[model samples]
Target: MCCAHKNENRGAFIVLEGTDRSGKTLQCQKIYDYLISIGRKCIKTEFPNRSTDVGKLLDGYLRKTIKLAPEVSHLLFTANRWELNDYIEKNLQNGVDVVCDRYSFSGIAYSSGAINLDYEWCKSKEQGLVSPDLVIFLDINLSLSSSRSGFGDEIYENIKDQNNVYEVYQSFSNYSFWNNIDASQDPDVSLKNC
Candidate 1:
């Protein structure tokens, strides 16, 4: 027989994945807040966190102010995640739940969306990073997603790129821990199921 308390100390690593304007940021905040309200130890983070040097490069690429080669940009994005790998692992090991706005999935989808890099090539850079225990993928149709505000700013924010990223996210369904949520529906109802 297993001890019921043995698993209590392993905090959940929850990752929110979605295309641009899919309300991932808001939902991550909501989930984080809800966890806190319930008195659970929680921490929230976002990729391209923009606080680290690697993240600064990613922010520049996203803003289109700096033009790095697609491959190089991809590496920088992966490096940004690597920069946080230790923190995330330690937090979870300490039983602090982590809610991430984006993760390796974003790295793969965004890079593949840009340079048409092989999926494996996009994924290889992220190997050995800790995987989220639960990945909540918010699915928003391209048509509906495009209609939302702030959809046309960055270098890779166009419909073509968004569609490609959506396809890439779909491939993640093979992972048993992935949960796909339809964001086109009411947020409250979606949250209930998420």
Candidate 2:
């Protein structure tokens, strides 16, 4: 059994979330490397992990070669997270900082964007999973983000889809523990704030 009270120095779980081209990937890497440089044990990972079976399905869905219902895709995304829950929990327990590029919030935003599902329905599936100690949201202007990195062939990479997801993210802004950071500045400045 896991002890409720453990060492005070247990590592923190940090999640970085943002729209595409919002610099979240770079920020996640920077944070992970910084933690390592400080002698903290850390592991960085991303959602739609693309390594597991469920992730493979998600990859296919994103690729558009295989069609899945919006709800089904949402469940798959949730299940992918479920697969990593234990690993994340154990790592934190062992004093390892787990840095995630994207997480449940991304799932909620992206899935809810694709389908008009209840926010409750989207959030309910993640209720008991370990929550991040910190969630840094790299908020970037939609047009700027899209301009930096043009839309890809992925299912949710278009302007319309991104707009919807952005709204969804805004809707849940109050319910979760998140820090919204303006990502329009230099990466160094962004990292300093985050």
Question: Which has the greatest lDDT?
Answer: 1
Error of 2 at 112 (Å): 1.2
Q: Model 2: residues >4 Å from true position, as ranges?
A: 1-7
Give the alpha-carbon lDDT of every model.
0.87, 0.84
For candidate 1, write residues 1-194 as lDDT tens digits.
Answer: 01122456878888999999898998999899999999999999999889998988888889989999888988998999999999988898899999999999998998897568777898988888887788999998888978888888778788888988888889888887789998988777777885
TM-score of each: 0.93, 0.92
Candidate 2 lDDT, tens digit per residue, 86-107? 9988889899999999999899
Looking at model 2, which ten-residue stretch has the lowest summed lDDT?
1-10
* lDDT score of residue 97 within candidate 1: 95
